[model samples]
Target: MTVNFNARPLTKALIFRIQKQNMHYSNSKYWDFCAPVAGILLTLSFAPFDYSWLALAAMAFLFAAWRGCSAKRAALRGYLFGLGAFGSGVSWVYISMHDFGGAGALESSLLTAVFAAFWALFPALAGYLSVKMKGPGQVILTPVIWMLVEYLRGYWVLNGFPWLQLAYSQLETPLAGYIPVLGAYGAGFIAALTASIAVEICRGKKRLLLITALTILWGTGALLRNQTWTHEIGQPIRVSMIQGNIAQDQKWRPENKINTLLKYKRMTEEHWDSNVIIWPETAIPAYLDQVQDAFLAPLANDAKLHNTDLIISVPVQETAPVKNFNAVITLGKEQGMYRKTHLLPFGEYLPLQPLSGFVLDLINIRLGNFTPGTATQPLLKAGGYPFITLICYEDVFGDLSVRGLPDAAFLVNVTNDGWFGDSIEPHQHMQMARMRAIETGRFLLRSTNTGMTGIVSSKGEIVGQAPLFQETALTGTINPMGGMTPYARWGDRPVIGLMVVLLLGLLGYGKVNVGRISVTAV
Candidate 1:
């Protein structure tokens, strides 16, 4: 008698045991403990750490935690994950609130917590919706839902905070190739999709198909990197960026104001041979009307004498409604003024009226009450070429950065990162600025107060950078670029519209399939 040893049943039993074990753990306290740790892992994927690959693993961990869970449980896990991510990632808010906003350490901590918790709700909503929309095509549905919620968080709520976006973390990866074609949000969707597929593969679902899909997605991105989206239009021009390294607390002091002006002026005079010179945000530390004649006129004359354009940032007090604008003005060889359109909600202006006022007053945190500038303002000219100007926080918005593109030859961002002190905020800010360069295929000349002043190439690589916390002149040459990247042409609309359609299609398909199965069973 020949005994046939059937190994298929034994293999099936082993696989079933493993899956059951996974399900039990996923529904237990283990997932709750793992959620926040996964968030920290996500934070580590960003600047100052830059473990980009960890981003995939981090999201996979969160997805696993959400799998086989109810919507409420998933939301809780997501909220915990967000608390960990934002708490560690943007704790620099504490530095700004305590060090600059005049809030006590304890008060700053509480306010910072509140800020993180509030933003965490976006992820919670994503988790809740993901579970509600779960179906046979959940691998695709989960990532689409996640990115849609990220869009709401980054563009809509409270004037938007686009920081800590997953796309920014993938700047060094092949996924960055997607930026020019799809912009930041689209790239983020790809990243989220990659992570979602990875989670499903681990669950032993459509392993071969998911693997092939990932290979195609990543391979296509790698190929896209070699494609030229924008080209140089003019000769390389010498540019100088002066980092004033001005202390936030002392910047507005009456006595230090003159020294600040003189410091930047002295630095500019040294680099006058350059085609263009840039000063960081509010480098003048005073209203434009106050210094137009006494300081700016002579400086403009000197810049003209040296055959260079001087681009500087100063607060402009406008009359009609007595509104104050954070403005950038170009002088010397060219003349133009671009007022900042996007304002940092709490930092530049308060929202929610009396309620926000009362809360801020309770913390004794008095912020600027500046008004936003018009969006249709003309582009500023420097080095005899038109350029887009992003004042401080404006560069974080990818859509905002591309508004003047194709026409604008390069990008100039004037920022004062000193408010966050010697923290990761400057590094993160510089990282996002580099993404803008890649998205628009324009050289980005980023001038910052107190750190990370640098010239970013169209490929998102650093051409030249200054040491953090140093007062020095960073000199680099950039060729003015003229051409339209797909992102520059259509902005985020195409990607957003595509996401919305995919979500709706998946929901419709799932319903139809469910209906057919129910009728057949009956």
Candidate 2:
């Protein structure tokens, strides 16, 4: 009898099942490689590279890796991916810590690792919840959980580090049209949902349905791109954004302070013909009380003569024990002030004040102690236009940036990005500033210390920009917009509510007894 050497059907079926299982929750060593690769893809999807489509691919890979995974294995996979994403995407943190904050290399690396790991827990939580809530709707539930966690991550810990959010990558894409309607969380929801559906298509589960859904979802965004939500209330005004490019090391030195003041003065004097001339954060580099007479008074007089409004960043002294404020003060026809409300943790002040002494001993930085301004502060007036102000790190918080609302005519973001050196931080900062303009439906006038000084339209387009590390001025015209986008009116409340509803609907649909989404390995 001739024996057939081909494998039996039963054997082939078992092999196929094993392969599918491995794609979901593999005990194989290859997962270590796959997870990190997926993470790097995610990192590349943001700011510098802006390969936004890769974000969907990254999420698909991650979702596949997480499928059928025990909570523990899923957490590990998620953590590894986070390591890859933040390790590369936020490597500038190390630059800030070691290069500028006077920290040792090992210390900075360890601190950065801890920071990345902490954020990794959010994605890990999403994975755990997805598996525990597994059912026919697991794909839909996964993205909802992803968006919820992202929203929480924006404000829950240490006043939040809302950088590299998935939706931010889509700002250049048609999907960004969702921002004005549903805010960043809404764009994130669609992005995550698209990613999950892509995973389903890859598994051959719902190819036609998933493709159609994606087409409709993305096509709607393309259609909404041309929709006008806000309109110009006033004519475009000439704005001059001066980039002094002052060295971070010399900015605080008493000797170099005079030269710094003189440099900004000379630059502003040259641009006096402009309607509004602005300076970067802490441009004065001295107490407001000290500079008001010598520096500010003279500048204000010159501004009055030229019919120009001058907005400059300076530290304002308050009552005792409250600490000083990072503030922007205006001098001209329309005079007002705005203090920074969303202060950066560690950069602006230590979060856990009990350990402040111990933490300060290890790493040192300038202007590390700052008091947050009141949330209801009035918008600063520049050249008879009301402008919302965002100092340095303040623009990262989108919801907070629009506090002034319909009352504010435009946005002014003054940042001293010289600390990060010739790194990606400035570029990333500018991107967030643009998003703020989109969220509020107002033009953004950004003035930075080293570069990225420019005018951004309400539509999130860069109208004009100065070169990085250049000591020059970006001169342009931007209209003062009056109307508010839905995001400005509602903030993230609607999106957050929708996420909660979806999650509850998923749990209610399956009657699955999900006691707790814990990190337990199989």
- CA lDDT of each candidate? 0.90, 0.83
User: How high is each candidate's TM-score?
Assistant: 0.95, 0.92
Candidate 2's TM-score reads: 0.92
Clashing pairs in 2: none
Worst 10 residues of 1 by lDDT: 513-522
The most accurate candidate by TM-score is 1
lDDT of 2 at 37: 79
Task: Estimate, for each residue in 383-402, the C-alpha lDDT of model 1 and write its tens digit.
Answer: 98999999998899998888
Model 2 lDDT, full chain set: 0.83
Model 2 CA deviation exceeding 4 Å by range = 1-25, 363-367, 512-522
lDDT of 2 by residue, 322-397 (tens): 5788989899887777878888887888778757557667565443678888988877788677778888877888
lDDT assessment of candidate 1: 0.90
Query: Count of backbone clashes for each model?
Result: 0, 0
Q: Which candidate has the top score in lDDT?
A: 1
